[model samples]
Target: MSHIFPRHSAQSYPVAVGGEGCYLIDDTGKRYLDGSGGAAVSCLGHGDPDVTEAIKAQLDQLAFAHTGFFTSAPAEALADLLVEHAPDGLDRVYLVSGGSEAAEAAIKLARQYWVEKGAPSRSRLIARRQSYHGNTIGALSAGGNEWRRAQFGPLLLNVSHIAPCYEYRLREAGESAEAYGLRAANALEEEILRLGPDTVMAFMAEPVVGATAGAVTAAPGYFKRIREICDTYGVLLILDEVMCGMGRTGSLFACEQDGVAPDIVCIAKGLGAGYQPIGAMLCTAQIYDVIAAGSGFFQHGHTYLGHPAAAAGGLAVVSAILQRGLLPRVQEKGDALHARLMEQFKQHPNIGDIRGRGLFRGIEIVEDRESKAPFDPSRRIAANIKKAAFEAGLICYPMSGTIDGKHGDHVLLAPPFIISDDQLDELTDKLSQALNAVI
Candidate 1:
């Protein structure tokens, strides 16, 4: 009877009528624990009064403003706050509506930066296989998730894809983790050389691979080597933190733990914490200065760029993250959650790996733990797990085609920063039940 088009036309969905903290209530009053934070978007959890009030106040003062003619106070303030806490050398913020737009802007900016520097041929982009950037044309071209790109292959750009820093699948039997990490990162250098370094503009990747790869963190020393390669080849290192940044991975920025800063970083999801649709693309002042000194125009824009109300909500969410001492809590609680997962699934036959940082964690489902073999794609393991978990009144992110975009599955858990110990227990119990029923 609904006129709206649904994400899955064949499936009817429960109406989310209300939410409180870590739980969402349906019209029939079924409460689902928000274990995955609704695709890791609701970091502060649902119905936070502070974020709501900020948006409301902004709407009262000024609901919207076009960035062409003017910039709003909220937008300026939000950008300032983001840059204040961002990684070293990243001094500029370009606000957008969400993750896709942020990534689209980052790609265009990277291309523009090279052009302004008089290197117009530096238009190629290299990203990791099994990685996801976003869904727009440029962003999708940069992503290496084959499933998402299969139907749109002809429309995608000619972006190169290197091997991912996936230790579990790619590491040799006797290689040390550190050695494997270095080897994984060196793939970027090889690809850049093969393609001619002069033609490479940027290398894009998620600090902690999300969605397609299920919170896959890079091996130790991996990002450091990547930074070195990009530096040597004059290729800009662009880290897409759209799903893993904004304190989702224990740090304010996910790359902070990796001990390297990127030339440009994109963030969303947790920025406005689902209170408002907002995202930002931040870059080094050096890059900004290049365009500033040249054309003084980036030649890119969106209607909702630097939207006032969204900016206000993002400012409040980020302020709460810093002011209310939630970063440390995310770490502390993340450790606790990881420990519980390990203890619960240690002897389980099908659970292959438990990995990730902060509240972002992934449980890789395998046919056999000894061989680390994935379930057959025809089994639809991830899809069934998602269905079972939803029926069990728990919301989690389980994605199929995790390995090479075809033959693996993983369940990603990204609970809210405010999830209580009791709620953690409930989440684990529900997830366990779902796994048992499906696996």
Candidate 2:
């Protein structure tokens, strides 16, 4: 009997004793391929020497320095590197501990920005349905995932939700992808008008939907239209790149590929490459200036904000990614991985769709291909697939509630950037076995 509390106490779990390259080893000495990088955190894979060394070096020198008192070299350097690589106008970085923290900071910053600019009425937030910002209260209120928000509805602040740009399920038969994209993106405009444009502070979304929707990508021109809407309404665009940014999408920032620069962006998970927990919210110079000139302070701080060791790990991870030219490699491997998945599942009746970009891919499951019907939620297809994959020496990220709050299932694949072709082949093989055994 273990004294430690677990995520799910009803079920036992393997103790992950060690990790190397793209695989994790259990206490029993079994190696499981990290197919989803533990929810897309380990971009450089496990046991990265450079990142580990950076963390250790930072710890040796100094571990904690409160932001109110001082700023460390690692924090400054990390911020500089991130800004240099960030989208145009995004000149400031507010470092935080993880995805939820990043989201919380972004929300507060947006509200503060509006207030500083004399738009105190801009307090409402609009996000897409089926999207996930984070788990904290403020972030949770901004998120639109039904299951996650259902129980917390009473406690959550009022936030509006519009339809997401999910083309596969929502796209009409006669509609071109571009047309559907425009239609979906137009939902924001309608929502803004309904809520009174002056009252809305920001519109939040994940450039590439992760976890909740399983690596879903927006259609062409979708984000361009979204950017246009934000600008037209004076609404700040906040892109939550917690799972898809930092080279996971084969681009430094996923929004770059979409050719749109958000006013505020939240990033995490892959930022530190699982070497250390770190996340940051980047905002435009205009927003920063408004708050700086108005309040002379942002009115937010965390005990671990600008943590030296985490910043060091993030800096090292970004440095290694750029030095090794891993972004292009992610694109190349992603192409190979997509091809392998298509080849393997193209003929499978239960596999409904295979889509995504770079190392992040999703395999949507269905009971009938023609109808695109989901399996019974009670059947727990995604859960069974995850268990089967793990038992077969592969760790995957599978989740239910894909269609809404309770209906669909998808397996999200986000292998480490360091994964090889052979490892991809292994991933597909194990996935096929898991699907066959469970689905």
Candidate 3:
């Protein structure tokens, strides 16, 4: 009976009428705890007063201002704050409406940067398998998630994919973490050489792989090696932090934990905490300078590139996170949540892995703990778990195709930064019950 088209056509969904703190209320007055923050977007939880106020103030003053003619205060201020805290050498910001836009912009910018630097042949992009950048054609092309790219393969640009730094599945026995990391990182070097290094424009990756792999973090020295590989080939390194950034992983930027800096970074999702749609692509001074000196303008734009309302929401969210010291709080809560999961599920025969950083954690479900074999994709275990959890008045992010965009299942937990210990306990209890019922 609903006119609005939903993601899944056949399934009936509850009407989300309102939100308060970490809970969403349906029209029938049922309350569901937002355990995954609606795909890890709502970091400050729902109905935050500060973010609400900021949006209201922006609307009162001005709502939309096209970026072609002018830039609003909120947009300027947000860019300044982001640049100030960004990794070394990244001195510019390009705002967009969402994660896919930001990722697309990064790709275009990388291409243009090389062109401006007189390397027009550098057009190829190399990303890791089992990685996801975004859903748009360009971003989707950059991503290695096979299922998403399968039907749209012809529309996507030609991009090469290498092995992901997935230690759990790819690491060989008798191999040290560092050794496996080096071996995995070497894949990029091999790909670059095979592609003819000069023809490669960039190497893109998620510091901690999100959706496609379920909050998978890179091995200890993996990124350091990636940085070296990019530098060796003069290839730009673009880190897609749309899902893992913005303090989801205990740090303001996930790359901080890896001890490596990328040439360009894309961030979204938690940037505006779901209050408004906002995403940004930040780049190093060198890349900016190349474009500035050559064309004086990056050849790209969208109508709602820097809407004042979205900028205000993002600025306020960042302000609230810093003012309330939520970054450190995420670390504390993340530790507690991990410990609770381990204590509860370590002996559970189907739980294969409990791993992640900060509030962003993933529980990989397997058929046999001894073999770490995934549940049959035909079982649709992740979908069943999600539906069961929602029916039980809980909202968790569960996804299938964890192994190769077709097999494996995982539940990604990215509770709000404001979540309390009690809520964490509730999340675990609901999740445990859901998994039990499904498996």
Clashing pairs in 3: none
RMSD of 2: 0.7
The estimated TM-scores of all candidates read 0.99, 0.99, 0.99
Q: Estimate candidate 1's alpha-carbon lDDT, on a 0 to 1 scale.
A: 0.95
lDDT of 1 at 220: 90
Candidate 1 ranges with C-alpha deviation above 4 Å: none
* Candidate 3: C-alpha RMSD after superposition: 0.7
- Given candidate 1, what's the lDDT at residue 141? 93
User: What local distance difference test score does each model get?
Assistant: 0.95, 0.95, 0.94
TM-score of 3: 0.99
- Residue-level lDDT of model 3, residues 313-350, one tens digit each, is 99999988888999999999999999989987989999
lDDT of 2: 0.95
Query: How does residue 354 of candidate 2 score in lDDT?
Result: 96
